[model samples]
Target: MKGLIFVELMNFMEEQFGELLTDEVVDAAAIPGDAAFTTIGQYPSAYASRLIGAAADRSNASAAELCRAFGRYLFCRFEVRFPTMIQRYPSARSLLMHVEAHIHEEVRIIYPDARPPTVTALEVDDALHVVYRSDRPFAHIAYGLVDQCIASYGEQSTVEWCEGNDDSHARFIIRSLHRSAA
Candidate 1:
């Protein structure tokens, strides 16, 4: 994982749970190197999982829920950080359709060591079928990101987790409610 992710996670925790709880969670997670992550630094993915687990243990929300929420928050942060990348697409559907070919490719170019998930979108009739595949177990995060992306685009859509072969593989079906009703 990249340090930017960890740094953003800390910011998300502080914003959502306050500084005290965030400090406690970080302390409990016991991440190496004082938990001071730089944007360009590389860290173990396990550290992120451990932090999420510790947060779940302290809070009422489950790890999956927290991951999803984090994803939502992360999307906003990404919008701020990479405005040009997002501005190229007029709608969330278009952005998602090119996530693998465009966005992730840009990420790889910027961060050669970063291992991002493969997000593939297929347009089927009135719905878009999105497939998420990754070595890390963060499909719930992807679900939340998709949810927020649609909402951010001012689109009325419903996203359903159609199936999951494993933690590494998940599929989501997104259909515009207005279009469907029409």
Candidate 2:
């Protein structure tokens, strides 16, 4: 993780946890009650806290390398129904599988040319799941995901639409809602 993200994490922890960190900050913040649960701290249990919310070197590090790092992190966290298809891009795509319908569309709106997931009844979970990268040009997706979800749904949704690129290569699920009976 970059020094900035580490520092920001510290400040974020203090703001959310009601106190600044110290020797026991790790334990106190990592506890189930801390606001850290809402941030990158959620992944520390799996050793992913090292790389969850930092920028790769614009100096030398490539996006693919960063995506791979993120992939490794998420693959260890989420239980994928289609692991093979998703195993390739855990950091970038897998986290998107559980998004709610309308919020997913709002996330797409964040990207100018981005589209939402094609809606499907599927085996279960009729909700929409869209993948919009969070960093780079698509960084606005993060702003959209959080803002729109709060606007359309409520302030309680924890779903995040963050990724590692700016250019829009968005994927969405578009399905019509109607009555179908035998």
Runs of candidate 1 with Cα error greater than 4 angstroms are none
**lDDT of candidate 2 over 1-182, digit per residue (tens):** 22222344444334433453321445533433332333222222222232222223221334344443333333232223234433443333223443434333544564433443332212225334454543233323333432332332222332334344333444333222321211
Q: Output the number of the lDDT-best candidate.
A: 1
Clashing residue pairs for model 1: none
Provide the lowest-lDDT 10-residue window in model 1.
161-170
RMSD of each: 1.1, 15.5
Error of 1 at 14 (Å): 0.5
> Candidate 1 on 1-182: residue-level lDDT in tens?
88898899889888889989888898999987758899999888889899999999999999989998998999988999899999999999999999999999999998899889999999999899999999888888898899889988999999998754455788989999999798
Query: What's model 1's lDDT at 140?
Result: 81
